[model samples]
Target: GVASVAISKCCQVSDVFTELCIASRTKSKCDALAAKLAPTTRTKITTAQVDADDVQQLCDLINSYKPDLVMNIALPY
Candidate 1:
């Protein structure tokens, strides 16, 4: 929880993060976080429903986003 918030906040302040995708298996949580940060940050925030354990899903997201960086902060349930 702390890590996700902290990272998102960091991204908010830095020019390096022009865009951020806050993905989680629980997409509502990601949406909440994105909503909280969206008003204050210039970073373009988006949310996606994703299962961290699924290789194909992860790969698909990576391919689609083609991000310069990726942070997997998901915890095992």
Candidate 2:
């Protein structure tokens, strides 16, 4: 995924992102992406399985993470 690769590149610049969570509809894909990005990133990588189509689950995820900022990479088309 472009976002994962791009994020890995961003990490190369500096330790910008301290806690980076990659949540996707496909949990394994998220894990795989993190694994690929791990070696090149200083950011702490975490993975979560999320179905964006689920409103309740999405709310739960946000609360669980309690992120200072949220970047919605999966933009609605």
Candidate 3:
């Protein structure tokens, strides 16, 4: 799961990613994913309702979160 991935990354880099923002059209799904990831990982995960197809919205979220990197895992369709 996401927590495992974060843990793996932390092990590799010797630094835990503290803040993460999950942007998805469905807030519930994002929330669920974050919840699942929270217990096992050291990162602070957050969710935002956003339409990936909307460039402006994505931009806004990116600006608000200001993540070190944006991981685009949205569906193609």
Model 2 lDDT per residue over 20-57, tens place: 88888889988988888788767788889988889998
* Residue range 1-77, candidate 3, lDDT tens digits: 46435434643442456677776777897788778767766777778899878899989988888878776653456
Candidate 1 has its poorest 10 consecutive residues by lDDT at 3-12
Instruction: Tell me the tens digit of each residue's lDDT in model 1 across 2-76.
Output: 757776766667587888888888899888888888778888888898888899999999999888989876555
Off by over 4 Å in 1: none
Off by over 4 Å in 2: none
Count backbone clashes in candidate 1.
Answer: 0
* Per-candidate TM-score against the hidden true structure: 0.86, 0.82, 0.74
lDDT for 14 (candidate 3): 28
Go through the candidates in order and give the clash count of each. 0, 0, 0
RMSD of 3: 3.7
Against the true structure, candidate 2 reaches a TM-score of 0.82
